[model samples]
Structures are given as structure tokens and as C-alpha cells.
Target: MKTIGVVDTTFARFNMGSAVVDEIKQHVSARIKRVTVPGIKDLPVASKKLIEEEDCDLVIALGMPGSKDIDKVCAHEASTGLIQAQLMTNRHIIEVFVHENEAGSDKELAYLMEKRSREHALNAVKLLFKPEELVKQAGTGQRQGFEDVGSIGM
Candidate 1:
């Protein structure tokens, strides 16, 4: 059976990883192994362990970064580490992040996180089983949270 490893940080008030798992279950039947770390910095090690030890097919990492410059720097470091983990394991790691300042209000930020998390979960499922489903979104100016970036120039 296909397995997905979910890694999230507790620095944020929301349980975004749970939201991703719940959404994935709605459309796919895959085993989900979740591990919650203290902060974004801890996600990489936990993700590596989940794939190497737990035998997961893929990993989903979720975190909420604050507005400060230091927070962004830390988030960047954590994301780079996650990428390295993926390279080492030869598995996909969907890194989902929502900045606390992405939206103007708490409600908006929450909504963006929920929408992005659920969408990324669906993306993970598609990556595993129905890759064709993901093709439909290519180059489309449609996305959750902020406006879509669409296809950039070559």
C-alpha cells in the first residue's frame, strides 16, 4: 500500500497537517504516518526518519512562519533541509508553508492555510496515483490563497 508521511510544526496554532491528511483520505486510500515537531527546524529530521524508517512513499511538511525576517530565514533553512532529505531518500516531499503575514487578518490567514494544506494533500495523492489529475492545473492561472503566478516566461 502507498504510504504518506506527514510532518508538521507546533509553533503555529493550527493543525494544518491534520487538515492535509483528512483531505487526502477523502480521495485516496493510503496509509498516513504523522509526526509533529516543535518547530519548522525540526521537520527535516523527522521527515527523513519517516521515509527511511517508516517506509513512506512520500512526505508532506507543513509549517507556519511568522512575519519577522528571522522567521523567514529560519523557514528558508528548514525548507532547504527538507529538499536535501528528499534528495537523499529519492522521494517526494511536498513542503507547504503559510506565512503568518500572508494575510491581513487572522481569519484570512487561517482560511489560506486550510485551503493550501487541503490542496497540497490532494496534490500529493495525485502524485502517487493519478498524476494526470495534476496536469490539468499546469499553466493555469488558478490557485488557492493569493492569486496564481501562472506560467512564467522562459
Candidate 2:
């Protein structure tokens, strides 16, 4: 069975890890491992550990950046680290970052978190089991948390 890792940050207001796990369980049967860190910057190492030590085939790194310039910078730094980790491990890390400023209200923020996490979880499943599904979706403007913009007419 394949192992899927879920790395989340405690700094996030929502429990995106649980949302991802729940979505994954609905689609396929795989070993799901979860790790929690203090902040987004910690996601890279946690994800690497999950891949190298826990034998995960793929990872979903979830984080929420606050609505501030410094937070955005930190998110970018974390994203860079995640990319490096993926290069070093030669594995896929599906990043699910929901910036606090993306939503106008608290309720919307929570909804976006759950929706994005679940959608990315399904993407992970498709990547591991049926990558062709994604190929079919290429250029479809498939948004996770918001309404999909749809494909443009030729």
C-alpha cells in the first residue's frame, strides 16, 4: 500500500490535515501519516522526514499565512524549502497554502482551508493512482477553494 504524508502547522487556524485525511479516505486505501509543526517554515523538514523516514510516497504540506507582509515572506521562504525538499527526495509534495488575506471573512477562510485541503488530497490520490486524470484536466482552470474559471475557448 502507498503511504501518504500530511504535514500541517499549528499556527494555522484550521485543521487542514484532518480535512485532507478525510478526503483521501473517501477515494483510496493508503497509509496516511500526519505530522504537526509550529509554523509554516517547519513544513519542509517535517515533509522530508515523512518521505525519508516514514516512507511516504507523497506529501500534502498545509499552511496558512497571516495577512501581513512578514507572513507572506515567511510563506514564500517555506515554499522554497518545500521545493528543495522535493528535489532532494525526488518525490512530490503537494503544497496547500491558504493565505489569510484570501478570504474577506473568518467563515470564508475556514471554508477555503477545508475546500483546498480536500481538493489537493484528491489530487494526491490521482497522482499516485491515476495520473491521466490530471492530464485530462490540463488548462481547465481548476481552482480548489474558489469557483473554477473553466477552460478558455480556442
Candidate 3:
């Protein structure tokens, strides 16, 4: 059985880790491990630990950046660290970040968080189990939280 790790931040307004786990469970049978940190910057180490210590095949790193310049900068820094962790572990860490300002209202924000989390969870499943599914959709514009802008005539 494959192990999927989920690292999320407590600073996020939504419980994206639960959303991810729920979505993954619907598609495949895998041991899902969850780790919660205080902020986005902590995602890399937690994810690395999940992969190196917990024996996870893949990790989903979820975070929400507030609507501020510093928050955006922190999000970028976290993303860079996540990339480094992936390189160090030679494993995939699916980065799912939803900026707080992406939506205009609370309802929209919640929807984006849920949709993005679930969609990325499915992507993780496909990556581990059926990567060819993704190859078939290549070049077709696919969006997670919003409507997919279909492929252009190439």
C-alpha cells in the first residue's frame, strides 16, 4: 500500500488537509498521514519528514497566503523550500496554495479552497496510480479551483 502524506498550515482559514484526504480516499486505498504546522514556511520540513521518516510516496503541501505583500512573499519562500525538499527526497510534493485574495467573498474563498484541494488530491492519485491519464490530457488547459480553460488550437 502506498503512503500519501499531507502537510498543511494552521494559518489557513480552511481545513484543506481534510479536503485532500477525503478526496484521495474516494479514489484509491492509501495510508494517508497528516501533519499540521503553524505557517506556510513550515511545510517543507514537515513534508520532508513525512517522506523520509514516514515513508510516504508522495506529499501534498497545502497553504493559504493572506491578502498582503508579506504573506505573498512568505508563500513564495515556502514554495521554494517545497521544491528543495522534493529535490532532496526525490519524491513529488504537490503544492496547493490558495491565496486569500483570489476570491471576492467568503463563499467563493471556501469554494476555491475545497475545489483546489480536492482536485489536487485527485492529481496525486493519478500521479501515483495512473500517470498516463495525465499524459492524455496534456496541452489541454486544466484549472483546479475554477473552470478549465480548454485547449487552444495548437
Candidate 4:
């Protein structure tokens, strides 16, 4: 069985991490190992350790960046670190992020965060075992809230 590593933050509202874990479990039959950090900036190291030391087959890194300019910058830095970790470990990392400013109100943000995290968790499972499903959806507008841009000819 595959082992899934989940890395989440405590700073987000609405318990988005738990929503993500629940969604992942619905689609995958695997061992789930989770690590919770204090904030978004800490996700990279925890994810790296989960992959490098904990022997996980895949990783889901979930976080909610604040609505400030500095927060966005910090998220970018954390993402870069995640990329580096992926290269070092030769494994896939699904970095799921929901910005606080994406919604107009606290309630909306909470809903959006939960929805986005669950969607990305499903994406992570697909990436690990059924990547062809994702490729089939390219340019089809099958994703929620996204428009079909049409496929490009190679």
C-alpha cells in the first residue's frame, strides 16, 4: 500500500487541514502520516522530513497564506523550499494553498479554503496512482470554477 504524507499548518481557520485529510482518505486506501506546523512558513521542512525520513510515497502540503503582501511573499518562499525538497527527494509534493484574500468575508474564505484543500487532496491522490485522469481533464474545463481554455496542439 502507498503511504501518504500530509503536512498542514495550525494558523488557518476552519480546520482546513482536517478537511483535506478527510477528502484524501475518501479517495485513497493507504497509510496516512501527518505533521502539523505552526504556520505556512514551516511546511517545507516538515514535508521534507516526512518524505526523506518517514518513507512516504507522496506528500500533501496544505496552507493558508494571510491576506497581506508580506504573507504572500512568505508563501512564495515556502513554496520555493518545497520545490527544492521535491527535487532532492525525487518525489511529488502537492502544494495546496488558499489565500485569505481570495474571499470577501470570513465565512466565504473558510468555505473556499475547505473546498480548495479537498479538491487538491483528490488531485494528489490522482497524481500518485491515476495521473491519466488528470491528463484527460486538461483543457476540458472539468475543474470547478475554471473555464475550458481548449487544448494546445503540440
TM-score, structure 2 vs. true? 0.98
Ten-residue region with minimum lDDT total, candidate 4: 140-149
Model 1: residues with Cα > 4 Å off, grouped in runs: 147-154
Please, what is the whole-model Cα lDDT of each candidate in the order they appear? 0.91, 0.97, 0.97, 0.84
TM-score of each: 0.93, 0.98, 0.98, 0.90
Task: Note the residue pairs that clash in candidate 3.
Answer: none
What is the per-residue lDDT of model 3 for residues 1-154, given as tens digits with 9 covering 90 to 100?
9999999999999999999999999999999999999999999999999999999999999999999999999999999999999999999999999999999998999999999999999999999999999998898999999999999958
Lowest summed lDDT window (length 10), candidate 1: 145-154
List model 2 lDDT by residue over 8-79, tens digit each: 999999999999999999999999999999999999999999999999999999999999999999999999
lDDT of 1 by residue, 73-139 (tens): 9999999999999999999999999999988998998999998899889889989999997787777
